[model samples]
Target: MNAPAYAHPQATHTVPLGGARVAYLLVRSRRRSIGLEVGASGLTIRAPLRVSVAQIESALQEKAQWVLDKLAASALRVQQTPQVDWGQGAQLPYLGGLLTLQLHPAAPRGCELLAVGEGRWVLHVPLPVDALPASVRGQVHAWWLRHARLLLTQRLQRFAPDLGVQWRSLRLTNARTRWGSAKHDGGIMLNWRLLHFRLPVLDYVVVHELSHLRVMDHSPRFWAVVASVCPDYTRLRAELRQQPIPEWDL
Candidate 1:
């Protein structure tokens, strides 16, 4: 069942949490109780249509400490994550290593990767020094997308057979929160941003989704399937969560 448009109303309000004032979006619907969610953008409160604003504020007051702690943590994460610099000498992650960007307007009109020496790699772009940052970012993004599709397709084919499952399709996703998703029809959706991590970490996400084809839920058996292929899946999973992604959006 779904709530009608009139049954759910949304508004923003500021409430006193502890001694500090914090703002949150309030969404009222025909739900059973009030729900509080703290995310990157901040707090959001979902309350039943029958709940009054005063009551909602009172509930928020009860969880003031929790809200403040989450906000502080979110702020810290934002502060620690570095934004990507789109220019010469900037580096991007590639197969667990850093690939430095080098602009050479006279070299060529496309992007090329050259191994310098001693495990050093450079991505050569044919763009002028005065080129806009957005232009550089756009070209790099376009190259990455094309590379991601081809590389990911090969990886899926390699892993599916070993895992005794036949994947029908592979779709690269730009999802914000999830790394991958599996459908009962053998369709797998993997975030293209996984290219930023090491090969082992990316393999963990691939194996995790393929395991879901055999077992739909996260049961003990499902975990066993994942562990059989990746004995260090727990560590790889942590790396995926802790690794800071370069600011992809220009």
Candidate 2:
């Protein structure tokens, strides 16, 4: 049976799947989901403690299609960018360019963020470890996403003139299922991580959502509209198919 939605997380547990240990992670959220999450090393699953191993396995098998799709997407994303260490002075892709981190010395009081020059962004810190790992990473990610949204907005603004479409608003989120979405009121939502991809990939996603303003579904006509805007949509789609959704957690 499906677990209760919005319930408190139960304790973590594990089960055997073909002799490999499959972790059953309990996640408390709007809905309970029992699925396999692929990571750099391998897979970690989330399921209610009461769910039997048999049921978990069945669910995992049923979700194979979804797992495969996300896995492919994640792989492509990782391959597109070179390997990076998750620490200080790490280089990350931002808006079609590489940004290197610089840990500064003492500041006035706390850390202040600013784009110092063409490639450098200074984090004015009182101490090296003041904004350790997560804090530092979070701030940088926020900057990247903010810059990405601005760039996307500029690009989408150009499309409105051609198609007579008005984009009401835009939001960035870590959505797993789709790259972008269009709302009835002409609003759009995109995965902020798209900033990590190449410009062509981002353009494809932007065009895909803009096309939705004219035709809301993936019918033949809607695809034609998308094709008109992104002639190489097929190649981009294939590249997208190759990557998996990198699961930060189960």
Candidate 3:
């Protein structure tokens, strides 16, 4: 009899552990210990410069259950994530509600927001219904980017005064791993994908980054500052992590 064989589609390194195939990227760095991170891209293993393959595999075998659990969760997340369609009646998350996409050929070449009903809004794209999906997606993406900057800026301004912090500049980022980050120099970069979340979740991130201006680390003092303004931040932060953003090819 032959043993079962497993394949890794996008893995740089493959190993067999606990009757399963584990695919990971092995990175040799100056670190002292083996660090593992599993994300949408799969597992990544960072090991010390002098670690041998046998040592690395031994470490992975020890953490096989944790690695498999993370991989399973990542797969589940990918499977449950909604994909965006660039056409009429397409719905997406916006400010704690649904934003539907509508096409109006005679409108114009740009996109506009229309209030359709309570807690509902329609994005009126100037393209015809027959427009290419890529074209429609590009136009809608541009609109989202423009509005993201404006909305994020407004929130930052609103919270900075309350937090007693001064922001030097803001950059809209497309980062996959981090929602927001702040530099010691008062520059903040926020992921535009945050538009997928509700306003409270968005505000939490805003207040979080601004608080870093006073305390650059995530120590007790920094969290105290965040709680000073957003007392329910703990809940909001968890919700932000649980809410899945729609996947877009564009």
lDDT of 3 by residue, 1-250 (tens): 4533333345678898777777777888777688887766677888899999899999999998888877777778878999988787788898888899988787656688888787789898988888888988898999999999999999999999999999999999986656899998999999998988889999999999999999876678999999999999999988976787798785
Q: Candidate 2 lDDT, tens digit per residue, 1-250?
A: 5421211123265444432334444443223456565543334565665776677678776665565555454545656645544345666654445555555555444445567576444444344644466666665556667676888888788766666678899988775535788987989998777766667888888888988899986679999988877889999877654544322221
Q: Where is model 2 more than 4 Å wrong at Cα?
A: 1-86, 105-131, 243-250
Q: Rate the local accuracy (lDDT) of all candidates.
A: 0.80, 0.62, 0.85
Scored by TM-score, the top model is 3
Better of 1 and 3 by TM-score: 3
The sequence of per-residue lDDT tens digits that candidate 1 reaches over residues 1-250 is: 4321111112278766776767777888777789886644577788999999999999989998888887776556657776888987888877787888888787556688788875567888888766788988887888788888888888888788878998899888986556899999999999898888998999999999999999876778999999988889999997886677776776
Residue 236 displacement in candidate 1 (angstroms): 0.7
Q: Give the TM-score of candidate 2.
A: 0.59
Which TM-score value belongs to model 3?
A: 0.79
TM-score of each: 0.73, 0.59, 0.79
Looking at model 1, how many pairs of residues clash?
0
